[model samples]
Target: MPYDVEKPDEQWRAELSPSEYAVLRQAATEPAFTGEYTDTRTEGVYSCRACGAELFTSGTKFESHCGWPSFYDPKDTDAVELVEDRSHGMVRTEVRCARCGSHLGHVFEGEGYPTPTDQRYCINSISLRLQPTDG
Candidate 1:
């Protein structure tokens, strides 16, 4: 899914914080562990607080200890878009919301974790909201 008509600057300002605007709208990343969801382990789907798009599930989370919220996979395959991130001094895959294009984080392969999926999705804490399911 692609982003729809953008909200006006005034409306965006009223809805989002400076950092939220920078990351969620402008595609910036907050520093590790400083975000709201890095240490969260609620039993729910993590959705886009801005648009309610399901991005992650609590089940895939692991204590990566990488200072950011880490996941092995997304809750839905269509929830995100991955692009080649050639920024900084390394090559990484930049992860974003497929619907709203929110800056989620980076995905790296082959970290040698003990899991079957040797992938680490180091994500921004501010980009997600825990919506616990009625189990």
Candidate 2:
């Protein structure tokens, strides 16, 4: 699928930090419990760090103690894209920013979460930038 914001490899590298580029572009996972938003409870929207596309919101975020920021749903149905990941000798659903195709994280389901959706969108903090809502 073609993305709304597409850029060359060099451009992406130049824009994102080393760690951000790894998770957002190379599909690498950050260390568990080490992300900036793992325990964030502020009211805001989380947008894709690479392209500023809104992906998840604070309303959908929950504490799963899984080390990464977890959300039961995205800000919108079309805000993200899921792909079948067969890497690391296992199968999982990988999530990406729909607008830029930057790797966000993985989504899991059927774990018995107490949210409207039983799904969990485990996203990398480096892949996101939080915009706090003002009163």
Candidate 3:
């Protein structure tokens, strides 16, 4: 099927590669330490992989050791949406694109961090693109 940016299902497949689409749109998780942003220490903002919407920043990211990119808070409250995820026989808060409502990942609480926000935004690399700021 031809991918279309205007079409949710089609654009998702077209805009993202198979692996990116699977993890970003379908909420499928990549193997531990397999994500590109997992160990990223760059100084910049992280935008959506599917869309160029700013979500998190490098300052908000912390070493959660969860094999995924973890952030203490998001750059914007409306940049991402949250949904009730009931997959894998457990309830989780699913994160999505506020603009397109694309699945991003899950956020967890009590991650034991000392950021402005104590919450951990366990995001997927396929769901984000780090944009380094001016040096």
* lDDT, candidate 1, 1-135, per-residue tens: 437535666776688888877878776888876877888877788887566789889999888888888899998887888988877889889988887777788888798876658999888888788888897
Whole-model alpha-carbon lDDT for candidate 1 = 0.81
Q: What is the C-alpha local distance difference test score of each model?
A: 0.81, 0.97, 0.82
Candidate 3: residue 72 Cα off by (Å): 0.7
Enumerate residue pairs that collide in model 3. none
The TM-score that candidate 3 achieves is 0.90
Model 1 spans > 4 angstroms off:
4-10
Regions of model 3 farther than 4 Å from truth: 1-6
TM-score leader:
2
Structural similarity to truth (TM-score) of each candidate: 0.88, 0.99, 0.90
Candidate 1's clash total is: 0
Which window of ten consecutive residues has the lowest lDDT sum in model 3?
1-10
Q: List the candidate numbers ranked by lDDT, top first.
A: 2, 3, 1
Best candidate (score: lDDT): 2
